[model samples]
Target: MLWLDVTHRPGQAPWVRLMGRYLLPPCKQRWHTCAAFLPQGGLLVCGDRRGSLLLFPCSSSPGWAVESAGIADGGTSPVSEDTGSGSEPSCLSHKGALPLEAPLSVLFGLHGKMGVTSVTCHEGYIYSTGRDGSFHQLRLQGQQLEVLRKHRPCKGLQWIEELRFTPDGDLLVLGFHADNFVVWSSRTGENLHCIPCGGGHRSWSYCSNASAEAFAFVKCGDVMLYHREAEPCEQRVLLESLHGREIACVRRLGAVEVPGHTTLNIFVTGSEDTTACVLALSERSRAAMPLTRLSDHISSVRALALASPVGVFGLLEAARKLVLVAESFHHQRCVLKVEAFLHTWAGGERHLLCSAATDGSIAFWDITSPITDATDALHRAEGEIQPLGGCSCQRLCSASRGRPRWWLLCSLPPSTTFFHVPDLAELDCWEVAEAGGELRYYCVLCGRGLEMLHGIAPPESPLLGAPQ
Candidate 1:
């Protein structure tokens, strides 16, 4: 698929073009976690079963190979060689070797044979909860790996399925079978709060935009929005009976588009019923609209992310256009994830439609050529436009400034891949064992560009008598 550069004014072609056919070696086991674009350029961290972790660089050079396999059982005693002298029975034993590899080195022998279920990073510290019911904090000091904090058998949380940080840096953990979530102070590891929601065998939870004053969580068929109040806490069901099926993923739309009215917060939910819906929330009531019906996969959806603004803007203007990407499923199946990017254009003349999809392969289509005026076109077209290309994994995310220099994160089955549009070739890929993990790209706190980047220049030196 061709990656078009949409940051520039429409009609300007992409500056870089790379084929989207390169495939990495398959892993011995499935990936359990994936992180993209570390502080270092073009580097990704992936963790998996067998207690292994791998780091892949952006380039194809030999220097890119790095591995951290799991640890082995030390040979502190001999067992099989023992022979019974008389009546005492002799026992036979087998020696277990340690799995030494790079990514595993980062975990520092904290994770056990049950393997890791969730991983997240905050500040410079990496926090992960293992299947062994342990929570660990791993920090990097120069080249040494240190365990800052380790909690064996987290008090109430078991089988951590997801991890998120509140706006205040409070860690929010979702327990798989326990039916509860815990919020902790990151600095002190003090448990601040624990909230319970009904649980399901395969349910997952995620927080909305971190900066929001409140957050929301969805599991099974329920979506609850929580607001922090001084007097008492309040939570209401914004939308329930979602998709008439099990909810797999929830994502908050970045910002809304309203000409003159106050914009409201919106969220999109994907479910196991082969349907996805968009929900708009306001002080008065919640309205949900069905967005798409994905029919190819029989399993529950594992990942969902928003596209870059280039795709967003095109869809906003036309309300209908076609673009597609490659996508894969948790069952190691590949299918196309397609949707229309639609928006009401100038003068409300037409509903502009731009489409995007992932079919395990990349395909590009430019629908900018206007076909008809807005009013007449809406009634005439029966459906939205469809974009090209397919994605293996559903973990989609886009980052951009004012312009359309957005990057798309595609979480494949065994690898986490990245592609920048409108030049839609694979920019980088990291071998990760799991899907539905989270990765973020942001400057370190107190690092360079933290202040200057967000700083606004002082108002021009005003003369003693500046113009009123």
Candidate 2:
């Protein structure tokens, strides 16, 4: 296998010519079947058809990141040297420039049964479905993966083509080759709903609407939209339709919210028809509304993901005066929907929203802009900002030129970088203050605080926007 290292500047797409490639060791079984980026860091995990899982550290791997205070000679370009070959993820900085083929470490030797078809990561756990009809969960402990548990094999469940975890983490949905989808509990192996209809169950995505009531997926070449009558239970599909061609991908985009007008759900889909289509969904009894079509790509558009617009957007939406507070994801062990939360201390109270996890993990976050009020406790708190062990949100990072983020004080063993934060249910508040360029945070729940950074300059921080 070959890897291309290209430098892309803003506003420019990168182009790498595929000159040639090298062959790997002869394997009679299937080659690399699937690859995934680990949530913990930059480790790349790939599973071959022969049941062998390999881990590629990549030139941009996070190994060099943790060990070094700064990127040592980390720059743009490819230089070379031959250290021969061994099994371990390789980074470009360690080898000077770049290597045509970097050795990959073995994540799993060989499954006695079969190979993996679908792989996904949530929090610190990795879930994979194998050809042998098994759903396996692995936990990342340091650089190694410890097998946590695997679902009991179903007698005739063949070819799990796709897997998705609901935002609540209560459901583990599996799409099969036989044009049907099944839901199961992520923690327990109890089988739940089995909905069989439409096509493209082989390629499907689960996206929740603003109310978190509906989800849409593609089966065969058709789209099916379902509404949850109960919280994560009892679903009724409001609409279903067949596209003219194979539905390649469907993703839910942020919908426009109206005060009195019926809010229309919006989603975009790409197809083998070489066209991207937009459709509208209504909460009331009706069919999916077709919006417009654009034939941009020459070939099938394979994937669709949501991202913040790079250029100006939300300008008109901003005029609507939406005060953005915080973002959210699922934290299962803690029973909280979020794993960790962060904000500039200058933000006022309710500027912070916190809930506890069962594992003693807590996240406090203020989603919107800072409102100055000296009487506010959160406004006085500064500097001692850090995230917990199992934080899957944006990580605390540093660079030679960019600013450095502070570390969260953790009670878990020093070796543990991530924690499940399974211990939260009540309000755990904190306050911040800065003295002589150093920031300190006081935990109202634990009656403790840690001093964060010492030389934090004015431009390096915004929490100090108003000087005490």
Give the top-scoring candidate (lDDT).
2
Clashes of each: 77, 30
Model 1: lowest-lDDT 10 consecutive positions:
444-453
Error of 1 at 440 (Å): 55
Task: Point to the candidate with the largest TM-score.
Answer: 2
* TM-scores for every predicted model: 0.30, 0.34
lDDT of 2 at 54: 60
Which tens-of-lDDT digit does each residue in 145-220 have in candidate 2? 6677655323345555446666665545464435555555433434555566543324555544435545467655
The lDDT per prediction is: 0.39, 0.45
Q: Taking the tens digit of each residue's C-alpha lDDT, what string does model 1 give over 227-295?
A: 554344386655434454455565555446577755444555565555445655442333444433342
TM-score of 1: 0.30
Residue 254, model 1: lDDT of: 40
Give the C-alpha lDDT of model 1: 0.39
Model 1 residue 168 distance off true place after TM-score fit, in angstroms: 5.7
How large is the C-alpha RMSD of every model relative to the true structure? 28.1, 26.4
